[model samples]
Target: MIIDYSEQLIVQEVAPRDGLQIEPTWVETADKIALIDQLSHAGFSRIEAGSFVSPKAIPALRDGEQVFAGIRRRTGVIYVALVPNRKGAERALAAKADELNLVMSASQTHNRANMRMSCEASLAAFGDIVALARDVGGVTLNGTVATAFGCPFEGRIEEDRVMRLIDQYLDLGLDGITLADTTGMANPRQVDRMIMRALHRLTPASLTLHFHNTRGLGLANVLAAYEAGARRFDAALGGLGGCPFAPGASGNICTEDLVNLCDEMGIPTGIDLPLLIELSRTLPALLGHDVPGQVMKAGRNCDVHPVPEYVRGL
Candidate 1:
């Protein structure tokens, strides 16, 4: 299908939350706050600052409240927090999270494994969370359908199942919806098909695509989503993320790589690529290991390299 891509795309930076949640090394709360502050200046309209789930479940992000309280909140950028249930939603609201991102896997097996509940139970809990958000009265909610493309535990997910989840999200009055490729099992063709179907029912503004680079098709999937008229995407700095619960799930789509791709293609992402690349470069030292982002190693297209003397002579 021919797709006329939008001139502007919304890149929601999820590094602090999804990116840091599974890191083996502990990043200081101060460092995480600092990173969010820096990213806030890089023109991201939405940033997943942290998650409000049980610290026992995700020890890495135990400092979610502190991080939210510490960061210098920008005027236009919305700070989001991932919430698992009503308690999490209440905590996120207390922390002044601009948006709450609630997730449930489309595959029942995966949902049971990840959230320890049946798919119906998870949706019911999400309803309570949405009610809590309404009571709070200032926070927006985003419903994320995890494993929308495919699942490692359950294999391919059905399109009808995904559509039903989206219907639930809309019925719950969620301000946004995200289709997550939780294990990076999505291909470009699959992405296009799913997103096109979603677009038939939702607008570009309310929909977001969360892709992983585990199989090296993250950016390709983004392109496909864009072709299907999706304008919002979720990405992590330096591709620093994986799901400890989901088997074989690896890095998220790199924030720098996605921005660079948009810049090269004349797509307006409203992000500063050089600033993002600089942040990506610091991950190796911060996490005590090199990250998976490519832009930090390859540099931008405009970054010309000097020719070697031998090559110049030739």
Candidate 2:
């Protein structure tokens, strides 16, 4: 497979929403706001600031409203929010979110467990949420098909099921669609074939890939998707987050790692690697645990040291 370097890919930073969702200690509202602002200055065109999910379900983000209100809105940055239903969409709209992201699991069992609703119910609710976003002039709608790869509970999800959901998302007049490997069950080959088929079926602008590093294949799968013509990807600052419903699942692909790979390959993601690394360093103190992104642990490939005087003399 060949990648087109001339094309510019879009990276949607999801650290605030997907990244911190699984942390035990609730990330303070101010910290979350600062993180978003830092990510904005790092040059992400779109940053998922917060989610409108119920505080009871995702307690880590209970301060979603406050976090949304606290961010410093940048000129070109588009702040997106994850909204599960019409009520969440309303809350997001009230908070002045620029975009609304709606998620539905490709696996029926995961869907029921994650959203507490059947797949059909989620699809039906999608239309309502899309309409709600439309009612507010500033908000755009994005639909995510979670567990597009293998699901922990449902095993391997069929390709047709994912395609059907994508078709439904398009029918809802959704502005974008993200295919999520919520369980990290996707491999490089699977990513290539599936993304290739999806590329043929959907426009480049409408498709986004969300991969997990649960099995350490996140970046490899991203390379496969990139080769398959995927230009939009979802990444977290420090490899944070996992699906609460998907047991044993880990974090999303590291933002710094993704940007590093793109940069080394001459792919113009428009993300600053050094700034992204700096932003990632704050995670250890902010979340109270070490993160798993490789680039953060070991500096970039081009990092060098000056020759010691003793060595030069020798």
Candidate 3:
């Protein structure tokens, strides 16, 4: 199939929410705010700032409200918040979140485990949340199809189900839809097929692909999705997140790596790669561990090395 190589792509950084949610260590409120402030200057059009879920459910991010309020808001940047239900949506709106992201897993078993309810219940909750956002005024709504690619417990999810979810999301009057791999079970071929069909039903403006590097194919899937005319993506700084409820799930695709790949391929991502790398380098110190971003560690492909004196003499 023919590919589109010239369009600029969108990468929504989800490190603050998806990345930090599953961390065992609690990132300090000040550090979390500082991290998000640094990310805003990296030229991200959108950033998942935090979540409005119950603190008891995800204690690592228990200070979501504080984190969102403490951040230095920047113009031209949309700060997103993951809101689980009507209550969470109200909290997000009160916190002035630019966008409200609602999620439901494609796998029934995974949905019950992650959302603690049936798929029907999640949809019902979304309807209420969507109405609340509309009533609140000036807030955007985005629906996420978690485990859209595969589920650890249930295995493969039917593509028809995924397509139907997209339709339902549109019917609900949401602004965007994110198809999350959840556990990195997606391959390049599968991404192409799924994304192509997905693009057919909705504008690329409303479609975002969220992939993980658990199987080392996250970037490959991004390439496939881009080649198939899908332009938006969800990546985390340092590849720092996974589903707390999904067994064996790993982190999301690395933001620096994704931008580096786009830069290498002559694709414009509008993100500051060096600045992102600089921020990524700080993660290890802040989180007290190494990150999964290769570009942050190895530097970009354009980086030059100095020749040794012995080699010069030789």
Candidate 4:
């Protein structure tokens, strides 16, 4: 029987950046490097290896430079880094990141609280970072709209605000733009409507979805976006991430679970589910807490049950 599946989905593994940033205890540079290397070997084409934020702000990823420098650069894999400003962009470039992900929030209040700057200031900084990445870094630039769906302090963000930020990023000549539900308040209807609007103005090639499962609608939201023509997504191993600004924000959608969904639906994500589970199992020792990913603990659907001898006789 021939079964048709959706086109291949590009999964950008974001464990090192979004995953580690919220953790209280810092992961060693060696472990971070090893994790990146392992994910690369596991067939993830793009991996967000680290963020170049201030060590004081996110002590968990203080060794961003060392982590990027130490990773074994495998061919056919793109190493990406999240940069908040020109300084972070410079550091990421020095470490030879293949892609520079510059972030700005949609909500004014949340932007100030998270990045210590207003939305306008962060957007202005994005242009500078984009120029630097092109002129000096020789890297592709990606702009992210953090808290795109809703803000913890400010509540719902208007769709115009999200599109406006994306317009500014597009003006900067960035290769792509990612819309992140930093607080995970996005519903399928909202995602479908927003992404459809984005598609009308921008090519789907230049769009990416960064969803968190904080409100438990992450996978549904992804499906909504996919139906609206979005092919790229950002996920973390063991569903690791949360908002420091949002009181009860949860982890990003789990990579293994997403891959399982893709595999079942005949969508090509190019990620090894078993290897992702193995990678997720190490999180307890690394983060000192239980993660939210179910597939890592329960195993996949293909994990067959053993038949009893009496049943076998029948």
Candidate 5:
């Protein structure tokens, strides 16, 4: 498929939610709010601020409400919260989330494992959540297909199945859809094929790609999706995210890396790269360990290295 190279891409920063959800160490509500505020200032139009799920399931993000309420919201930026069911939807709505990001794995095995429900049951519950969102009358909804590329237990996921899930999302009146590479199993070819198929059914603005760097193909897959006409993507700050339910999954596609790729390619992302890099650098101190992002370790291409001492003497 031919892609229009001139189009700008939208990058949704998901570090506050996805990035911190699986951390072994606790991130205080104050720190989460501070990070969200910083990201808001960095010019991300959409930020996954937090998730309204059971504390038992994801203890790392238990302070979703406080984080969302405490952050200084910037104009033109949409703060989103992940909602697993009607209850989560209520909490997100009460907290005044700009958008509710609903998720269900495309693979039956993964849905059963992560959500502890059948795919049919999950969809049924999502229908109820959508109704609640409609009644609330302010918040929008985005449906994410987890394990869209491949599943750890189920192996490769069928393209047709993913398309079907997209249909379901649209039927439920979701404002957007996100195809997630839950375990970093997507290749360029697969990404192109799936994205092309999805673009046929939805506009570029209504779709987003969420990738993981488990096997180090996250950025490659992003490029392929862009080539296939996908213009929106999700990345975590400092590459700090992985699914506790999806076995072998690693951190998300790095926000600075993706921004740098777009910046170098002359594609406008409207993000502040230096500010994002500064944020990435602070994660190690916050989490008490190094993060997976590479740009912080290897400076930008424009950053020059010092000449060797022998060459300088000569």
Candidate 6:
């Protein structure tokens, strides 16, 4: 099927929250703010700056409030904060986050492990968060269905479970929902079917696709979703996140790689590729290790090569 070339896709950077959540080294709070500031200037309308959770659970992003407080807010850029329970949501709201991201896995086992609560309990908490946001009256709430694809622990989560979660999120007054491939178990065929079905219920503006590259099918699933008229996506810079709870999970899809692919496909992501690559190159030094993003290393497709000396002599 042909793509609609005129559609401009919305990509939310989840690196600050998802990417740094499990890191061994502590990312200085100033660096986190700087990273989000750079991303803000790079044309992203939404960025997941950090999360307000227990420092005991995720030490890396413990300074979530400081991060939200320090970032240079660009006009029209939404600074998102991930919140787990009512307390976390309260912290995010206090920090003046532009949006609150709520997460729960579709699988019962995964929800218990990741969220440390039963599915029903997590929903109860979500209800409180939703009411809080409604009363607060400015911040947008986005519910995320983690492991919407096959769950590594449970395997093959039923379609009904995912659909029901979407309905529940809507019923609770959440502005939108995200379908997350927590362990990257989704294939393109499955992605196409799910995207098509999800689009029937939610507008492209309200639904987002978050994929991990664990199985190397992340970009394929993105293409599949895009072809199915899904426009919003969540990606991490340098492909820098994995579930601390899920076994065999890898990083999220690299932001530069996704942007480069969109650039090639003539899809408009509105991200500055050169600036993003420059920021990505700084990541290796910041994290003290190499990252998996390829476009930053190899350069974009439009980069020109010089002729070899021997070839020039010929």
Per-residue alpha-carbon lDDT of candidate 2 for residues 1-314, written as tens digits (9 for 90 to 100): 45468688789999899988878997778888989999999999999999999898889888888988889999999999999998998999999999999999998888888899999999899888877777778778889999999888989999988888888888889888899999799999999989988887688887999999999999999988888888899999889887776677668999999998888888899889999998898789888888988899888888877899999999
**Candidate 5 lowest-lDDT run of ten:** 242-251
User: TM-score of predicted model 4?
Assistant: 0.95
- Each model's C-alpha lDDT? 0.91, 0.89, 0.92, 0.88, 0.92, 0.92
Residue-by-residue lDDT tens digits, candidate 4, 101-166: 988889888888888998888877887787777788468888888889998888999999888888
lDDT of 2 at 274: 97
Clashing pairs in 2: none
The reply for model 6, stretches above 4 Å from the true place, is 246-249
Which candidate model has the greater lDDT, 1 or 4?
A: 1
TM-score of each: 0.97, 0.95, 0.97, 0.95, 0.97, 0.98
lDDT of 5 by residue, 1-314 (tens): 65566788899999999999888999989999999999999999999999999999899999988988899999999999999998999999999999999999999999999899989999999999999889988888999999999998999999999999999999989999999998888999999999999999899999999999998999999999999899999999889898775566568999998898888888899999999999899999999998999998896766788899999889
Residue 281 lDDT (model 4) = 97
Instruction: Give the Cα RMSD of candidate 2.
Output: 1.6
Off by over 4 Å in 4: 1-4, 308-314
lDDT of 3: 0.92
User: In candidate 3, what residue range of length 10 has the lowest lDDT sum?
Assistant: 242-251
Best by TM-score: 6
RMSD of each: 1.4, 1.6, 1.3, 2.2, 1.4, 1.0
